[model samples]
Target: MALRISKKYIHPPVSFLNNHFQFLEISEKITRSKIQSLLDEAYESRINNLSRSIGLAEEALSLSKESADKSFIGKSLSHLSLFHMIIGDFDLSINMANEAIENFEDLDDAKGIADAKYTIAGALYKTNDFSKGLTHLIDCLATYKKLEDYHNLARVQKSIGTIYEFFGDIKSATQSYEEAIDSGKKAGDLNLQSNAFNPLSGLYLNQNKIPKALAIIEESIVIKEKTEDIRGLAFALYGRGKVYTQTKQFEQAEQDFLQSIKIHEEMGEKLGWAMSHHKLGALYIKMNRLEEAREILVRALEYSNKNKIILIKFKANLLLHEIAKKEKNYELALKYLTQYVEEKESVINDRTAKVIEGYDVISKMQALELEANAQREKADIIEKKKIELDSFFYRISHDLKGPITSLMSLNYVAKLEVKDEAALKFLSEYDAQANRLNNILDGLLRLTKMSFNEDSKQEIDFEKIIYDCIASYKFLANYELVEFKINIDSKIVYEAEWALVNTIIQNLIENGIKYARIEDGNKPYISISINQEGDVIKITATDNGIGMDEKTIDNIFVMFFRANRKIEGTGLGLHILKRAIERLNGEISAKSKLGEGTTFTVVLPK
Candidate 1:
């Protein structure tokens, strides 16, 4: 018999009303206050008093509609949507969310629309409309990113990760989880951070990385505890309990599961309580506590059946069959076995129907994607011509470099030999122009070479490569005066194309050095940090230098777009760096202030 552990963990959809409430203005102050208070009460009581929460949200909705405040109506509807979702009324949730979206759109509220979409996505996922859920999630993700709403970004990412995990796309799931954690940190929301941490730890545990899994879950537990997120803590404890179970710490596992069940019961979360009891019963079976296992498994089946949780119901039946067989009750064992098989078949049939529906959605998406791809093919033809143009430029730049080198050498010799002051001054100017041309040609050569070169992966010695980059910039002005702080673990193993990685690292270091502030009594510095997280390599370079304004920062990666003209650059460094990162299928971003400095972050897959 194949046993499957339940992966259905809860991550409550965030309340849209709270975030957008300040933006709303109602003519009737008393009505606005009343609606707002009801919404607040609903949100607060969601986990512990779901019915009450739903009642409060409905009351808010009625009040908002009577007051003719479209924004408040939208918020109230969104709240009701979330409340319905918590109780597994997914269809109702989706309906409410759609109505909320309509009201928000009427009010021209972007945040409200996005938040409602998120709630709809959550409901869609619960209803096994995976493709629709994903589409809505993508929309929500884009809106949140554009708004720079890191909290919502993290929430969306975590949901995306969960969907990917459900579909067996572990790699995409891992990346999404990492992104969620990063966004959560940026948002400074500990609860959101821990929410991502819980699922991420499960992924690690699935890979049998026990130590990493344990550490991650422990960190999540700490954060959840600190925030007094009781529901979140219950989930984290359940996760840690699984880790303990895997490591054969039966006693600890049992205690953890019991604690989780206790929390679930207190919070009046029937689903969580059922799931925790099922897990504890499984643990008891593993520990040979047959009687105890049988009792809890029966209770688990009762709750799951009552709630229509088919997955858990079937699983509990299977365990009960095992308990009956062990106790030598052959007839009872046969009955339990038959029930388990029937329920398992039902689950398979239900899953098959959902999968078919999912495939239909995917087929439609693919049709749209195919149309998009046809357009992309036309674009690719133009791109190919551009590549040819770049090839021609590459050859021209390469040929010009030799002559520029010769011209520079001749200029140097002439400067030494020239007798007249006027002639020598002209020679110096000519030399400067020639050198500038040479630098431009060099930059072009590197850029075009990257465009044409085939990617070849090799083990990256980050320590050596970074130091080499720093060493090359020693002759730059203020290079000696600027402090370099490097933090990299020598043991990190990353593999990528050598040239692309070198280009990314070199340009960032050179930018830091070239733009270093040279004021007396001020210490200019650059900090470089590299670390590997799973299959991704993250490199961050920070500098307290002559930073660019917002407009300049926006255009920094454009070819020949100079930020600081006095600094004497080909203006191709950042452009080339960005191209190199793109060539390697990585991401690069910059954050800066006019005076404070800039930090460039590059993320690459290993």
Candidate 2:
């Protein structure tokens, strides 16, 4: 129910190398001129070498400026605008698009003007200026229609529908999406037609039209699969997963989510990876697989945090709070709760600003389009308030961190000064709780610090890291009986961060021993093996323990997830290991059966 159709299922509008953009017609003069070579190469390399494409466009711009050719200048600026937009430099994209539109207008270039306007609309959309974006899209739609450019006309219509969908204008959005689908079919572009089904499915699903939504999504998946569009297929699968989840068909949903994740990983789509992880993790939580939920959510959090994706981070944190509470670690639960609250408030404020900004833009555009100025001033005032509120929230959040740190330091000092035996014992308990709180705060601070830390990559003696991790486990009470079988080629050197690799191996090794089955009939043992294949180093750790089921394996790495509640732990060991592997630009996975054993595998680029 929470899911909606999205433009992300389609390739981003601003990426110039997309098939739709590449097919746009150019003027005869420009096509025949020397500048044509640069433009052609730019288009060809746009997908494979974006920076080079931009550089070529810049060269064309410089030449055009020297020649004082309005046509060349407009086309070059349009290219630059689209390239910038694709790279997420929305402000620069807007400026360049405006400049391109002006030059195109001077030359009476209708197609050029329309292209520039479309780029401007895309920039506005990226910045959450939805009202202005819709205005530009409408303008571009009219131009493309007049020129009989059905391909582009459908593209603009699809974009307009997406905005309307976001604005909750379902009727208008459905109309626009249908128009897009009709146009795409007329143009014989099944791919574009396939695009319509995604949003349509979402719209139907939101209205609880289950059968209709399923039919539409199935159609989308079939079409995309036939076309062999990897990303499209993945998106369709993910959408289907959402619908299945809502319908409480969890087994089917899990399969769909896993299939989508596999494709996303292959395509290197981090956003899709994060989205599916968040969805699947939430599903696990609902199924009461706390361990698996924790694992997947931690992964979701890492990817979301790395990308500054606030929504997923908020969801991940909220679930982590639940997991911590389920484990009876009230201190850790509160820690996650604090982060969830902060992130939730921040996201709410951000969304509020966008909504206000959208209204402000709409009011101003309406005033201009109708040749009235009465409401423009009021709109400007609203915009100003939104900006001010944004700054205030940011400052307040930063300032709040200081008092938390002070409280932690004061609590530590109180523990050190306590004198009476009874009081000392009570103080010791309080100190443990306070330290847990401090650890959570420290984690938040560490995220900020680690973001800026440069990768310290070098040739590492990985076998040493494994042995050292094994050595650290000797300190664990009653853990000496757990046998370790080391199968490592000491001569094999791996290129990675020493600290991260060490941390990953240490945490994983410690987890194997800590969770080992210690019953009379079972001799707990851990098998650590390391091997190199081409440019990758694969490490496997197998343990005979009270292993997890399929669902548990899915979430074993989640933060604060104690799979074996009988063991004493903070539930952070595997979580930390997973995070460390992420830092090393590697991957970690687990396979386990309840009461049998577990096997963890890590793959790192060498």
Candidate 3:
């Protein structure tokens, strides 16, 4: 049995983990006092080497039992439960967790009991024993709340919310999410806050609250990026992608799904990967990219089936059925449809969302109406708060940019005037800091401006725009050494919001030049291509620079995100580009591997 503990939800960073051989070397000299410590260390190995971790855990358990060390025995059982959960062994994990809970209960250890319950609930949730899982989770929540362990409380609330969402109880789910956000804020846990934000954003999206959903998801993405929570970020990005899909923003939807899938694959999170693939396939199908859709749907189906992820499998099969039907493959279509129907029915029956038809509901109409109004009022407050923050950013950015620019100019002049080497150096350093600050402010202005602009489509010279974008980047370092390849169809005439298009092209071109792995033996070059495809203009920017890993690529467009810490960047370039693309009703997607390089494709309405 694969005991899979989802890094998407339950991630306790193993700060104490090191090479397994180091622990093995130390264990040879271990005393009875070191037995429990060794067992604890064994659990940490699950992140690096699960099989060895499990073996060490089993050895420790046996040693503890032989030594008659009840404490070590209990801890080893608890540790084993978590390891099992991580490897997708739900039954064994649940059994071990329960046993650990009993032992902790006997010893009157509240924290230990809570930890065991948390693991048990997680395993039970994965096993589809929702009612029982909820019971354990509620108990865990109560214990955490009583202990004022806000982080764990937030985690439990998020888990509970997920269950309620699964059960189709939106009201309960919303309440749980709200509680989770509150608790996470109190705990200062960005991971919990971001995790809670994902489901909550989905709930809002389901209700057709697009702005609210985007706001919530954007906030979640920011927090996830800050915490470097790749799984959490992927989940949040998927939620945003869903919102984009709902609004018929296919381009943005495709980009989000692709980035999310890349991150999920890199993290080895099967569920996220399957779901993202499923979504991307659906998007491709909607876009009439039948072959691509079919290919992705197959991957989604295979992974979901192997992992026993029912919902993702059901969705993938449904899309596959559609693709087969579209291709006029009746037999294949029928087969896919049948499988989809079976999975759907199985899921529906298993979930069996509880619904009540009661006459008393009519009598409570007046109170229900009041509650609705109150909820709307609360929503309005949230909207207003977001607006205020946006306004603050816009105003502060505008106000600061002027003074900063002036200061930079003054510093530059001071450097020129200063004769002493020390004074000149100090001025240059001050000037550099000022320039950095000015760049940040400029990025903020660009971000805030994104919301202010409306679609102002005009005749766009496709070739000229690309040329201008590239020209602006020529002043940057290595511009002369780096080769520029332009492949624009000279006859192509596109119409778009010129400012937004310009921003998008400029940032992308600049980033390709800025982050290119220049030191590497590979010749640094940027490939720019633009062509008209019916009513759309396809533009691609390919770079032979230092490429990004999936994790870094997922966050490359996030505000203040920088993939390579060794490189200097405002992190605002890609973010501003995304905002610009969104404003222009265009889509931007990227593909990259660690060393190969990056390719960004932009599709805009013509």
Best by lDDT: 1
Error of 1 at 331 (Å): 3.1
Clashes of 1: 0
lDDT of 1 by residue, 40-148 (tens): 9888776356778889999998888888889899999999898777666667888999999999898888889999999988877754466678788877886897799
C-alpha RMSD between model 1 and the true structure: 21.4
- Candidate numbers sorted by lDDT from highest down: 1, 3, 2
Tell me the deviation in Å of residue 40 in model 2. Answer: 7.7
Determine which window of 10 residues in candidate 3 has minimal summed lDDT.
354-363
Q: How much does candidate 2 score in TM-score? A: 0.46
Write one digit per residue (lDDT tens) for candidate 3, span 141-224.
Answer: 767867999988997888888877877779989999999999999998777788888989999988988899999999998987
The predicted structure with the larger TM-score, 2 or 3, is: 3
lDDT of 2 by residue, 1-606 (tens): 697779776656566566555554344355437676897788556533567889999998888887777888888999988877765566788899999989988888889999988888877764446767877887787688779888777778888887777677799789988998998888887767877888888899999999999998999899888876666677789889889988999999999999999877765555568878988998887788889999999988987777555667888999899999989999999999999999889766766666676656556755665653457667888868845654554455356568767876876787778778998787777777766655554443333333345667888887667777777778886578788898987668767767777777777787788878888689999998999878888899999988898777777777667777776676666766776787778898888888888899999887
Number of the candidate with higher lDDT, 2 or 3: 3
Better of 1 and 3 by lDDT: 1
lDDT of each: 0.86, 0.78, 0.80
Q: Could you estimate the TM-score for every candidate?
A: 0.54, 0.46, 0.49
